[model samples]
Target: MAQTISVAGLRKNYGDVRAVDGVSFEVDQGEFFGILGPNGAGKTTTLEIIEGLREADEGTVAVLGLPPWPRNSRLLPRIGVQLQASSFFERLTAREQLQTFGSLYGVPAKKADAMIETVGLTDKADVRVEKLSGGQAQRLSIACALVHDPELVFLDEPTAALDPQARRNLWDLLREINTAGRTIVLTTHYMDEAEILCDRVAIMDRGKILRLGPPASLVRGLDAPTRVSVASGVLAEDEAKDLPGADEVSDDDVSLTISTRDPSAVVAALSARDALDGVQIRGATLEDVFLDLTGREYRA
Candidate 1:
Protein backbone atom coordinates (compact mmCIF):
# COMPACT_ATOMS: atom_id res chain seq x y z
CA MET A 1 0.00 0.00 0.00
CA ALA A 2 1.09 3.55 -0.65
CA GLN A 3 2.17 5.73 2.23
CA THR A 4 0.03 8.73 3.10
CA ILE A 5 2.47 10.19 5.65
CA SER A 6 6.07 9.31 6.46
CA VAL A 7 8.48 10.58 9.09
CA ALA A 8 12.11 9.69 9.73
CA GLY A 9 14.42 10.87 12.48
CA LEU A 10 12.00 13.68 13.23
CA ARG A 11 13.19 16.09 15.87
CA LYS A 12 11.94 19.41 17.17
CA ASN A 13 13.06 21.51 20.10
CA TYR A 14 11.75 24.52 21.99
CA GLY A 15 14.46 26.52 23.68
CA ASP A 16 16.49 23.93 25.62
CA VAL A 17 13.76 21.28 25.83
CA ARG A 18 13.51 18.62 23.14
CA ALA A 19 9.85 18.33 22.16
CA VAL A 20 10.33 15.57 19.65
CA ASP A 21 13.36 13.30 19.75
CA GLY A 22 14.31 11.08 16.84
CA VAL A 23 10.75 10.01 16.14
CA SER A 24 9.83 8.03 13.03
CA PHE A 25 6.63 6.43 11.75
CA GLU A 26 4.44 5.96 8.70
CA VAL A 27 0.72 6.05 7.99
CA ASP A 28 -0.46 3.80 5.21
CA GLN A 29 -2.95 5.03 2.65
CA GLY A 30 -6.51 4.79 3.99
CA GLU A 31 -5.29 3.52 7.35
CA PHE A 32 -6.69 4.72 10.66
CA PHE A 33 -3.52 5.49 12.60
CA GLY A 34 -3.35 6.82 16.15
CA ILE A 35 -0.66 8.65 18.11
CA LEU A 36 -1.36 8.26 21.82
CA GLY A 37 0.39 9.77 24.82
CA PRO A 38 0.03 11.93 27.88
CA ASN A 39 0.20 15.71 27.85
CA GLY A 40 3.46 17.18 26.43
CA ALA A 41 4.49 13.83 24.98
CA GLY A 42 5.51 15.41 21.63
CA LYS A 43 2.46 14.12 19.77
CA THR A 44 1.40 17.61 18.73
CA THR A 45 4.94 18.56 17.70
CA THR A 46 5.31 15.51 15.47
CA LEU A 47 1.86 16.10 13.99
CA GLU A 48 2.61 19.75 13.29
CA ILE A 49 5.74 18.77 11.42
CA ILE A 50 3.80 16.34 9.25
CA GLU A 51 0.98 18.83 8.65
CA GLY A 52 3.39 21.58 7.57
CA LEU A 53 2.24 23.81 10.41
CA ARG A 54 5.71 23.81 11.98
CA GLU A 55 9.15 22.98 10.66
CA ALA A 56 11.17 20.19 12.22
CA ASP A 57 14.61 20.91 13.60
CA GLU A 58 15.83 17.70 11.96
CA GLY A 59 14.49 14.85 9.86
CA THR A 60 12.25 14.46 6.84
CA VAL A 61 8.48 14.14 6.43
CA ALA A 62 6.50 13.29 3.36
CA VAL A 63 2.76 13.81 3.22
CA LEU A 64 1.35 12.28 0.07
CA GLY A 65 4.92 11.77 -1.17
CA LEU A 66 5.79 15.47 -0.94
CA PRO A 67 7.91 17.12 1.70
CA PRO A 68 5.70 18.83 4.30
CA TRP A 69 7.84 21.83 5.13
CA PRO A 70 8.10 25.50 4.17
CA ARG A 71 4.31 25.58 3.94
CA ASN A 72 3.72 23.20 1.03
CA SER A 73 0.69 24.58 -0.82
CA ARG A 74 0.42 21.46 -2.94
CA LEU A 75 -0.16 19.32 0.11
CA LEU A 76 -2.65 21.71 1.68
CA PRO A 77 -5.45 20.77 -0.67
CA ARG A 78 -4.81 17.08 -0.13
CA ILE A 79 -4.89 17.12 3.64
CA GLY A 80 -7.29 18.24 6.37
CA VAL A 81 -6.33 19.17 9.94
CA GLN A 82 -8.47 19.69 13.06
CA LEU A 83 -6.88 20.95 16.23
CA GLN A 84 -7.98 20.00 19.76
CA ALA A 85 -9.09 23.57 20.29
CA SER A 86 -11.20 24.21 17.22
CA SER A 87 -11.21 27.75 15.93
CA PHE A 88 -14.15 29.02 13.90
CA PHE A 89 -14.87 32.22 12.06
CA GLU A 90 -16.33 34.32 14.86
CA ARG A 91 -20.16 34.54 14.81
CA LEU A 92 -20.44 32.34 11.75
CA THR A 93 -23.30 29.83 11.67
CA ALA A 94 -22.38 26.17 11.60
CA ARG A 95 -23.50 25.93 7.99
CA GLU A 96 -21.60 29.09 7.13
CA GLN A 97 -18.45 27.66 8.68
CA LEU A 98 -18.58 24.61 6.48
CA GLN A 99 -19.32 26.71 3.43
CA THR A 100 -16.38 28.98 4.18
CA PHE A 101 -13.98 26.07 4.63
CA GLY A 102 -15.24 24.25 1.54
CA SER A 103 -14.81 27.36 -0.55
CA LEU A 104 -11.10 27.30 0.23
CA TYR A 105 -10.82 24.09 -1.77
CA GLY A 106 -13.33 25.18 -4.43
CA VAL A 107 -15.97 22.81 -3.10
CA PRO A 108 -19.59 23.56 -3.91
CA ALA A 109 -22.01 25.06 -1.36
CA LYS A 110 -24.38 22.07 -1.73
CA LYS A 111 -21.58 19.65 -0.98
CA ALA A 112 -20.63 21.60 2.11
CA ASP A 113 -24.25 21.68 3.24
CA ALA A 114 -24.43 17.93 2.85
CA MET A 115 -21.55 17.56 5.24
CA ILE A 116 -23.69 19.21 7.92
CA GLU A 117 -26.03 16.24 7.79
CA THR A 118 -23.10 13.83 7.62
CA VAL A 119 -21.79 15.16 10.91
CA GLY A 120 -25.33 15.16 12.37
CA LEU A 121 -25.50 18.92 12.57
CA THR A 122 -28.35 19.57 10.14
CA ASP A 123 -30.66 20.93 12.80
CA LYS A 124 -27.90 23.09 14.17
CA ALA A 125 -26.86 24.37 10.75
CA ASP A 126 -28.29 27.80 11.40
CA VAL A 127 -26.99 27.96 14.97
CA ARG A 128 -24.16 30.40 15.56
CA VAL A 129 -20.82 28.98 16.65
CA GLU A 130 -21.01 30.79 19.97
CA LYS A 131 -24.41 29.23 20.68
CA LEU A 132 -23.33 25.65 20.07
CA SER A 133 -22.24 23.28 22.81
CA GLY A 134 -18.66 22.04 22.84
CA GLY A 135 -19.53 18.74 21.21
CA GLN A 136 -21.77 20.40 18.66
CA ALA A 137 -19.00 22.79 17.74
CA GLN A 138 -16.65 19.85 17.47
CA ARG A 139 -18.96 18.20 14.94
CA LEU A 140 -19.00 21.39 12.93
CA SER A 141 -15.24 21.58 12.96
CA ILE A 142 -14.99 18.01 11.73
CA ALA A 143 -17.52 18.74 9.01
CA CYS A 144 -15.46 21.71 7.95
CA ALA A 145 -12.38 19.54 7.71
CA LEU A 146 -14.23 17.03 5.53
CA VAL A 147 -16.25 19.42 3.40
CA HIS A 148 -13.41 19.47 0.89
CA ASP A 149 -13.09 15.66 1.08
CA PRO A 150 -9.33 15.66 1.52
CA GLU A 151 -7.58 12.33 1.09
CA LEU A 152 -5.86 12.56 4.47
CA VAL A 153 -7.17 14.01 7.74
CA PHE A 154 -5.44 14.84 11.00
CA LEU A 155 -7.56 14.92 14.17
CA ASP A 156 -6.02 16.12 17.43
CA GLU A 157 -8.05 15.03 20.44
CA PRO A 158 -11.17 15.23 18.32
CA THR A 159 -13.43 13.84 21.03
CA ALA A 160 -11.88 15.59 23.97
CA ALA A 161 -14.88 17.56 25.20
CA LEU A 162 -17.61 15.40 23.80
CA ASP A 163 -20.09 13.58 25.99
CA PRO A 164 -20.20 9.81 25.76
CA GLN A 165 -23.04 9.72 23.22
CA ALA A 166 -21.50 12.44 21.11
CA ARG A 167 -18.12 10.75 21.20
CA ARG A 168 -19.58 7.46 20.01
CA ASN A 169 -21.44 9.26 17.23
CA LEU A 170 -18.23 10.85 16.03
CA TRP A 171 -16.54 7.49 16.16
CA ASP A 172 -19.13 6.12 13.78
CA LEU A 173 -18.64 9.07 11.47
CA LEU A 174 -14.86 8.59 11.52
CA ARG A 175 -15.26 4.90 10.76
CA GLU A 176 -17.36 5.78 7.76
CA ILE A 177 -14.71 8.22 6.58
CA ASN A 178 -11.95 5.61 6.81
CA THR A 179 -14.20 3.04 5.19
CA ALA A 180 -14.58 5.42 2.25
CA GLY A 181 -10.78 5.30 1.74
CA ARG A 182 -9.66 8.38 3.58
CA THR A 183 -6.47 8.14 5.62
CA ILE A 184 -6.88 9.39 9.19
CA VAL A 185 -4.11 10.25 11.62
CA LEU A 186 -5.53 10.77 15.08
CA THR A 187 -3.97 11.88 18.37
CA THR A 188 -6.03 11.02 21.44
CA HIS A 189 -5.59 10.50 25.18
CA TYR A 190 -8.52 8.07 25.30
CA MET A 191 -7.04 4.57 25.20
CA ASP A 192 -10.37 2.92 24.46
CA GLU A 193 -10.99 5.25 21.53
CA ALA A 194 -7.58 4.40 20.03
CA GLU A 195 -8.05 0.70 20.68
CA ILE A 196 -11.41 0.79 18.93
CA LEU A 197 -10.70 3.15 16.00
CA CYS A 198 -7.06 2.73 15.06
CA ASP A 199 -5.71 -0.05 12.88
CA ARG A 200 -2.38 0.54 14.58
CA VAL A 201 -1.17 2.97 17.23
CA ALA A 202 2.13 4.44 18.35
CA ILE A 203 2.45 5.05 22.08
CA MET A 204 4.70 8.00 22.78
CA ASP A 205 6.23 9.54 25.89
CA ARG A 206 9.17 11.83 26.64
CA GLY A 207 9.37 12.70 22.93
CA LYS A 208 9.86 9.17 21.66
CA ILE A 209 7.61 6.25 20.70
CA LEU A 210 7.91 3.51 23.30
CA ARG A 211 5.64 1.00 21.57
CA LEU A 212 3.93 0.69 18.21
CA GLY A 213 1.53 -1.95 16.98
CA PRO A 214 -2.12 -2.95 16.75
CA PRO A 215 -3.84 -2.47 20.10
CA ALA A 216 -4.67 -6.14 20.58
CA SER A 217 -1.17 -7.26 19.67
CA LEU A 218 0.41 -4.81 22.07
CA VAL A 219 -1.92 -5.89 24.89
CA ARG A 220 -1.16 -9.54 24.16
CA GLY A 221 2.55 -8.83 24.32
CA LEU A 222 2.08 -7.37 27.81
CA ASP A 223 1.40 -10.80 29.34
CA ALA A 224 -0.27 -8.99 32.19
CA PRO A 225 -2.46 -10.72 34.74
CA THR A 226 -6.18 -11.12 34.28
CA ARG A 227 -8.42 -9.85 37.06
CA VAL A 228 -11.40 -11.86 38.29
CA SER A 229 -13.82 -10.48 40.80
CA VAL A 230 -16.91 -11.71 42.64
CA ALA A 231 -19.19 -10.57 45.43
CA SER A 232 -17.69 -10.18 48.86
CA GLY A 233 -17.51 -13.46 50.79
CA VAL A 234 -18.17 -15.49 47.62
CA LEU A 235 -14.86 -17.03 48.53
CA ALA A 236 -12.51 -16.31 51.42
CA GLU A 237 -9.29 -14.45 50.54
CA ASP A 238 -7.25 -17.48 51.62
CA GLU A 239 -9.44 -19.78 49.55
CA ALA A 240 -8.89 -17.63 46.48
CA LYS A 241 -5.14 -17.84 47.06
CA ASP A 242 -5.37 -21.62 47.10
CA LEU A 243 -7.26 -21.69 43.78
CA PRO A 244 -5.28 -23.13 40.83
CA GLY A 245 -3.26 -20.52 38.89
CA ALA A 246 -3.95 -17.72 41.36
CA ASP A 247 -1.07 -15.33 41.51
CA GLU A 248 -2.60 -12.96 44.04
CA VAL A 249 -5.87 -12.50 45.89
CA SER A 250 -7.45 -9.61 47.72
CA ASP A 251 -10.77 -8.96 49.38
CA ASP A 252 -12.53 -5.70 50.04
CA ASP A 253 -15.86 -5.35 51.84
CA VAL A 254 -17.61 -5.14 48.47
CA SER A 255 -15.79 -7.73 46.40
CA LEU A 256 -13.24 -10.50 46.34
CA THR A 257 -10.67 -10.10 43.56
CA ILE A 258 -8.15 -12.54 42.16
CA SER A 259 -5.28 -11.88 39.79
CA THR A 260 -4.03 -14.76 37.69
CA ARG A 261 -2.19 -15.55 34.49
CA ASP A 262 -4.26 -18.62 33.86
CA PRO A 263 -7.79 -17.25 34.00
CA SER A 264 -9.29 -20.52 32.83
CA ALA A 265 -7.79 -22.46 35.73
CA VAL A 266 -8.90 -19.85 38.26
CA VAL A 267 -12.35 -19.68 36.72
CA ALA A 268 -12.67 -23.46 36.73
CA ALA A 269 -11.74 -23.63 40.39
CA LEU A 270 -14.19 -20.85 41.24
CA SER A 271 -16.97 -22.62 39.36
CA ALA A 272 -16.33 -25.87 41.20
CA ARG A 273 -16.61 -23.99 44.46
CA ASP A 274 -19.92 -22.39 43.31
CA ALA A 275 -18.51 -18.94 43.99
CA LEU A 276 -19.22 -17.30 40.64
CA ASP A 277 -21.79 -14.84 42.03
CA GLY A 278 -21.59 -11.46 40.39
CA VAL A 279 -18.43 -12.56 38.64
CA GLN A 280 -16.51 -10.23 36.40
CA ILE A 281 -13.52 -11.23 34.35
CA ARG A 282 -11.34 -8.60 32.75
CA GLY A 283 -8.27 -9.22 30.65
CA ALA A 284 -5.49 -6.78 29.93
CA THR A 285 -6.33 -3.77 27.82
CA LEU A 286 -4.43 -1.23 25.73
CA GLU A 287 -4.59 1.12 28.73
CA ASP A 288 -2.66 -1.43 30.79
CA VAL A 289 0.00 -1.69 28.11
CA PHE A 290 0.13 2.09 27.83
CA LEU A 291 0.67 2.49 31.56
CA ASP A 292 3.28 -0.26 31.49
CA LEU A 293 5.20 1.63 28.82
CA THR A 294 4.64 5.20 30.04
CA GLY A 295 4.58 4.69 33.80
CA ARG A 296 1.85 5.88 36.20
CA GLU A 297 3.05 9.38 36.88
CA TYR A 298 0.53 12.06 35.90
CA ARG A 299 1.32 14.39 32.99
CA ALA A 300 -0.06 17.84 32.82
Candidate 2:
Protein backbone atom coordinates (compact mmCIF):
# COMPACT_ATOMS: atom_id res chain seq x y z
CA MET A 1 0.00 0.00 0.00
CA ALA A 2 1.07 3.58 -0.58
CA GLN A 3 2.14 5.77 2.31
CA THR A 4 -0.46 8.23 3.56
CA ILE A 5 1.82 9.96 6.08
CA SER A 6 5.61 9.97 6.32
CA VAL A 7 7.97 11.61 8.80
CA ALA A 8 11.78 11.64 8.62
CA GLY A 9 14.06 12.97 11.35
CA LEU A 10 11.17 14.99 12.77
CA ARG A 11 12.17 17.37 15.55
CA LYS A 12 10.31 20.02 17.50
CA ASN A 13 11.55 22.17 20.38
CA TYR A 14 9.81 24.32 22.97
CA GLY A 15 12.61 26.60 24.13
CA ASP A 16 14.81 24.49 26.45
CA VAL A 17 12.75 21.31 26.08
CA ARG A 18 12.94 19.12 22.99
CA ALA A 19 9.35 18.05 22.51
CA VAL A 20 10.10 15.72 19.61
CA ASP A 21 13.54 14.32 18.93
CA GLY A 22 14.33 12.81 15.55
CA VAL A 23 11.12 10.86 15.19
CA SER A 24 10.62 8.94 11.95
CA PHE A 25 7.72 6.75 10.91
CA GLU A 26 5.13 6.08 8.23
CA VAL A 27 1.43 5.32 8.11
CA ASP A 28 0.17 3.34 5.15
CA GLN A 29 -3.06 3.96 3.29
CA GLY A 30 -6.07 2.37 5.00
CA GLU A 31 -3.91 1.24 7.93
CA PHE A 32 -4.74 1.78 11.60
CA PHE A 33 -1.57 3.08 13.27
CA GLY A 34 -1.14 4.00 16.93
CA ILE A 35 1.31 6.15 18.85
CA LEU A 36 1.52 5.12 22.51
CA GLY A 37 3.20 7.11 25.24
CA PRO A 38 2.77 8.67 28.64
CA ASN A 39 2.34 12.38 29.26
CA GLY A 40 5.13 14.63 27.89
CA ALA A 41 6.26 11.77 25.65
CA GLY A 42 5.92 13.80 22.40
CA LYS A 43 3.00 11.84 20.95
CA THR A 44 0.80 14.94 20.72
CA THR A 45 3.63 17.15 19.46
CA THR A 46 4.43 14.74 16.62
CA LEU A 47 0.73 14.46 15.81
CA GLU A 48 0.30 18.26 15.68
CA ILE A 49 3.17 18.59 13.21
CA ILE A 50 1.69 15.93 10.93
CA GLU A 51 -1.80 17.46 11.16
CA GLY A 52 -0.34 20.81 10.12
CA LEU A 53 -1.39 22.34 13.45
CA ARG A 54 2.25 23.01 14.47
CA GLU A 55 5.46 23.48 12.51
CA ALA A 56 8.40 21.16 13.02
CA ASP A 57 11.74 22.75 13.74
CA GLU A 58 13.66 20.06 11.83
CA GLY A 59 13.04 17.21 9.36
CA THR A 60 10.27 16.48 6.91
CA VAL A 61 6.62 15.39 7.00
CA ALA A 62 4.60 14.42 3.95
CA VAL A 63 0.88 13.92 4.10
CA LEU A 64 -0.40 12.40 0.89
CA GLY A 65 2.83 13.32 -0.90
CA LEU A 66 2.58 16.97 0.13
CA PRO A 67 4.35 18.96 2.85
CA PRO A 68 2.20 19.41 5.99
CA TRP A 69 3.79 22.65 7.22
CA PRO A 70 2.66 26.06 5.91
CA ARG A 71 -0.88 24.75 6.42
CA ASN A 72 -1.24 22.90 3.16
CA SER A 73 -4.69 23.76 1.84
CA ARG A 74 -4.70 20.76 -0.47
CA LEU A 75 -4.14 18.41 2.43
CA LEU A 76 -6.78 20.07 4.59
CA PRO A 77 -9.70 18.70 2.56
CA ARG A 78 -8.22 15.19 2.50
CA ILE A 79 -7.52 14.79 6.22
CA GLY A 80 -9.49 15.09 9.46
CA VAL A 81 -8.02 15.91 12.89
CA GLN A 82 -9.57 15.34 16.35
CA LEU A 83 -7.49 17.06 18.97
CA GLN A 84 -6.88 15.64 22.47
CA ALA A 85 -9.17 18.27 23.90
CA SER A 86 -12.60 18.58 22.30
CA SER A 87 -13.28 22.13 21.13
CA PHE A 88 -16.39 23.31 19.37
CA PHE A 89 -18.01 26.58 18.33
CA GLU A 90 -19.57 28.09 21.46
CA ARG A 91 -23.31 27.55 22.06
CA LEU A 92 -23.88 25.43 18.94
CA THR A 93 -26.14 22.40 19.11
CA ALA A 94 -24.54 19.03 18.30
CA ARG A 95 -26.26 18.76 14.93
CA GLU A 96 -25.51 22.42 14.21
CA GLN A 97 -21.85 21.90 15.09
CA LEU A 98 -21.56 19.02 12.68
CA GLN A 99 -23.40 20.94 9.99
CA THR A 100 -21.15 23.95 10.44
CA PHE A 101 -18.00 21.84 10.32
CA GLY A 102 -19.24 19.87 7.32
CA SER A 103 -20.09 23.09 5.49
CA LEU A 104 -16.43 24.13 5.56
CA TYR A 105 -15.68 21.03 3.45
CA GLY A 106 -18.73 21.53 1.18
CA VAL A 107 -20.73 18.76 2.87
CA PRO A 108 -24.50 19.15 2.97
CA ALA A 109 -26.35 19.96 6.21
CA LYS A 110 -28.46 16.80 6.00
CA LYS A 111 -25.36 14.67 5.53
CA ALA A 112 -23.78 16.34 8.55
CA ASP A 113 -26.87 15.70 10.68
CA ALA A 114 -26.73 12.05 9.67
CA MET A 115 -23.20 11.86 11.10
CA ILE A 116 -24.66 12.71 14.50
CA GLU A 117 -26.31 9.31 14.34
CA THR A 118 -23.01 7.74 13.35
CA VAL A 119 -21.49 8.71 16.68
CA GLY A 120 -24.58 7.57 18.62
CA LEU A 121 -25.65 11.09 19.59
CA THR A 122 -28.98 11.22 17.74
CA ASP A 123 -30.92 11.92 20.95
CA LYS A 124 -28.50 14.64 21.97
CA ALA A 125 -28.36 16.25 18.53
CA ASP A 126 -30.34 19.28 19.74
CA VAL A 127 -28.28 19.74 22.92
CA ARG A 128 -25.83 22.62 23.18
CA VAL A 129 -22.09 21.78 23.25
CA GLU A 130 -21.61 22.85 26.87
CA LYS A 131 -24.70 20.97 28.01
CA LEU A 132 -23.50 17.63 26.67
CA SER A 133 -21.52 15.27 28.90
CA GLY A 134 -17.79 14.77 28.30
CA GLY A 135 -18.33 11.58 26.32
CA GLN A 136 -21.08 13.15 24.25
CA ALA A 137 -18.91 16.16 23.48
CA GLN A 138 -16.11 13.80 22.46
CA ARG A 139 -18.45 11.95 20.12
CA LEU A 140 -19.51 15.30 18.61
CA SER A 141 -15.93 16.40 18.01
CA ILE A 142 -15.18 13.05 16.34
CA ALA A 143 -18.28 13.39 14.20
CA CYS A 144 -17.20 16.88 13.14
CA ALA A 145 -13.76 15.63 12.10
CA LEU A 146 -15.34 12.80 10.14
CA VAL A 147 -18.22 14.76 8.65
CA HIS A 148 -15.99 15.76 5.74
CA ASP A 149 -15.31 12.09 4.92
CA PRO A 150 -11.55 12.58 4.83
CA GLU A 151 -9.45 9.62 3.69
CA LEU A 152 -6.99 10.03 6.60
CA VAL A 153 -8.00 10.78 10.20
CA PHE A 154 -5.86 11.82 13.13
CA LEU A 155 -7.26 11.16 16.61
CA ASP A 156 -5.35 12.46 19.64
CA GLU A 157 -6.43 10.63 22.79
CA PRO A 158 -9.95 10.47 21.38
CA THR A 159 -11.35 8.42 24.28
CA ALA A 160 -9.40 10.02 27.11
CA ALA A 161 -12.39 11.29 29.05
CA LEU A 162 -14.89 8.61 28.12
CA ASP A 163 -16.44 5.94 30.31
CA PRO A 164 -15.67 2.30 29.49
CA GLN A 165 -18.91 1.81 27.57
CA ALA A 166 -18.45 5.01 25.61
CA ARG A 167 -14.86 4.17 24.82
CA ARG A 168 -15.83 0.75 23.46
CA ASN A 169 -18.60 2.34 21.40
CA LEU A 170 -16.14 4.76 19.82
CA TRP A 171 -13.71 1.93 19.25
CA ASP A 172 -16.38 0.12 17.26
CA LEU A 173 -17.06 3.29 15.28
CA LEU A 174 -13.36 3.72 14.51
CA ARG A 175 -13.07 0.08 13.40
CA GLU A 176 -15.99 0.59 11.06
CA ILE A 177 -14.37 3.67 9.56
CA ASN A 178 -11.03 1.91 9.10
CA THR A 179 -12.76 -1.09 7.54
CA ALA A 180 -14.35 1.31 5.06
CA GLY A 181 -10.86 2.26 3.82
CA ARG A 182 -10.02 5.34 5.87
CA THR A 183 -6.45 5.48 7.17
CA ILE A 184 -6.31 6.29 10.88
CA VAL A 185 -3.48 7.67 13.03
CA LEU A 186 -4.20 7.50 16.75
CA THR A 187 -2.30 8.70 19.83
CA THR A 188 -3.43 7.07 23.05
CA HIS A 189 -2.34 6.40 26.64
CA TYR A 190 -4.39 3.18 26.92
CA MET A 191 -2.28 0.13 26.14
CA ASP A 192 -5.29 -2.17 25.71
CA GLU A 193 -6.87 0.23 23.24
CA ALA A 194 -3.69 0.39 21.19
CA GLU A 195 -3.34 -3.38 21.32
CA ILE A 196 -6.91 -3.93 20.21
CA LEU A 197 -7.19 -1.22 17.50
CA CYS A 198 -3.79 -0.73 15.94
CA ASP A 199 -2.25 -2.81 13.18
CA ARG A 200 1.12 -1.44 14.25
CA VAL A 201 2.13 0.73 17.21
CA ALA A 202 5.08 2.94 18.04
CA ILE A 203 5.80 3.27 21.75
CA MET A 204 7.41 6.57 22.64
CA ASP A 205 8.97 7.95 25.80
CA ARG A 206 11.11 11.01 26.61
CA GLY A 207 10.46 12.43 23.11
CA LYS A 208 11.76 9.30 21.37
CA ILE A 209 10.35 6.03 20.10
CA LEU A 210 11.43 3.12 22.30
CA ARG A 211 9.79 0.33 20.30
CA LEU A 212 7.69 -0.06 17.17
CA GLY A 213 5.91 -3.13 15.85
CA PRO A 214 2.64 -5.00 15.74
CA PRO A 215 1.30 -5.41 19.30
CA ALA A 216 1.34 -9.20 19.21
CA SER A 217 4.80 -9.27 17.71
CA LEU A 218 6.21 -6.94 20.35
CA VAL A 219 4.64 -8.98 23.14
CA ARG A 220 5.98 -12.25 21.75
CA GLY A 221 9.45 -10.75 21.35
CA LEU A 222 9.55 -9.79 25.01
CA ASP A 223 10.09 -13.47 25.98
CA ALA A 224 8.62 -12.71 29.38
CA PRO A 225 7.43 -15.45 31.70
CA THR A 226 3.77 -16.40 31.77
CA ARG A 227 1.81 -15.95 35.00
CA VAL A 228 -0.68 -18.44 36.35
CA SER A 229 -2.93 -17.38 39.18
CA VAL A 230 -5.46 -19.31 41.27
CA ALA A 231 -7.43 -18.66 44.44
CA SER A 232 -5.29 -18.32 47.50
CA GLY A 233 -4.89 -21.33 49.85
CA VAL A 234 -4.83 -23.73 46.88
CA LEU A 235 -1.44 -24.78 48.19
CA ALA A 236 1.17 -23.63 50.68
CA GLU A 237 3.69 -21.11 49.31
CA ASP A 238 6.43 -23.69 49.66
CA GLU A 239 4.35 -26.31 47.79
CA ALA A 240 3.58 -23.77 45.05
CA LYS A 241 7.26 -22.94 44.68
CA ASP A 242 8.04 -26.62 44.22
CA LEU A 243 5.41 -27.04 41.48
CA PRO A 244 6.71 -28.21 38.11
CA GLY A 245 8.26 -25.39 36.03
CA ALA A 246 7.58 -22.72 38.65
CA ASP A 247 10.21 -20.03 38.34
CA GLU A 248 8.74 -17.68 40.90
CA VAL A 249 5.75 -17.77 43.27
CA SER A 250 3.88 -15.23 45.34
CA ASP A 251 0.60 -15.10 47.19
CA ASP A 252 -1.28 -11.87 47.88
CA ASP A 253 -4.13 -13.31 50.01
CA VAL A 254 -6.69 -13.05 47.21
CA SER A 255 -4.68 -15.09 44.71
CA LEU A 256 -1.63 -17.26 44.44
CA THR A 257 0.45 -16.42 41.38
CA ILE A 258 3.19 -18.55 39.87
CA SER A 259 5.44 -17.20 37.14
CA THR A 260 7.02 -19.70 34.84
CA ARG A 261 8.45 -20.00 31.36
CA ASP A 262 6.77 -23.40 30.99
CA PRO A 263 3.13 -22.57 31.46
CA SER A 264 1.86 -25.93 30.17
CA ALA A 265 3.87 -27.80 32.80
CA VAL A 266 2.76 -25.50 35.59
CA VAL A 267 -0.88 -25.73 34.52
CA ALA A 268 -0.71 -29.51 34.28
CA ALA A 269 0.74 -29.71 37.78
CA LEU A 270 -2.00 -27.41 39.10
CA SER A 271 -4.63 -29.61 37.44
CA ALA A 272 -3.17 -32.70 39.02
CA ARG A 273 -3.32 -31.09 42.45
CA ASP A 274 -6.95 -30.02 41.88
CA ALA A 275 -5.94 -26.48 42.58
CA LEU A 276 -7.30 -24.97 39.36
CA ASP A 277 -10.04 -22.92 40.98
CA GLY A 278 -10.14 -19.42 39.59
CA VAL A 279 -7.18 -20.18 37.41
CA GLN A 280 -6.06 -17.47 35.05
CA ILE A 281 -3.11 -18.04 32.80
CA ARG A 282 -1.80 -14.87 31.22
CA GLY A 283 1.00 -14.34 28.74
CA ALA A 284 2.89 -11.17 28.00
CA THR A 285 0.77 -8.27 26.77
CA LEU A 286 1.42 -4.94 25.07
CA GLU A 287 1.40 -3.26 28.47
CA ASP A 288 4.14 -5.58 29.62
CA VAL A 289 6.23 -4.67 26.60
CA PHE A 290 5.46 -0.99 27.22
CA LEU A 291 6.50 -1.14 30.87
CA ASP A 292 9.64 -3.06 29.94
CA LEU A 293 10.59 -0.35 27.46
CA THR A 294 9.42 2.76 29.30
CA GLY A 295 9.86 1.55 32.89
CA ARG A 296 7.26 1.82 35.69
CA GLU A 297 8.25 5.36 36.65
CA TYR A 298 5.35 7.72 36.10
CA ARG A 299 5.67 10.34 33.41
CA ALA A 300 4.26 13.81 33.86
Residue-level lDDT tens digits of model 1 in 139-209: 88888888888999999999997899989988999999899999999999999999999999999998999
Which portions of model 1 miss their true places by more than 4 Å? Answer: none
Backbone clashes (count) for model 1: 0
Expressed as tens digits, the lDDT of each residue in 1-300 for candidate 2 is 899999999999999999999999989999999999888999999999999989999999999999988999999999999998877899889988899999999999999988998889999999999999888888888898899999999999999978999899889999998999999999999999999999999999888999999999999999999999999998888999999999999999999999999999999999999999999999999999999998998655
TM-score of each: 0.98, 0.98
Q: Scored by Cα lDDT, where does model 1 land?
A: 0.93
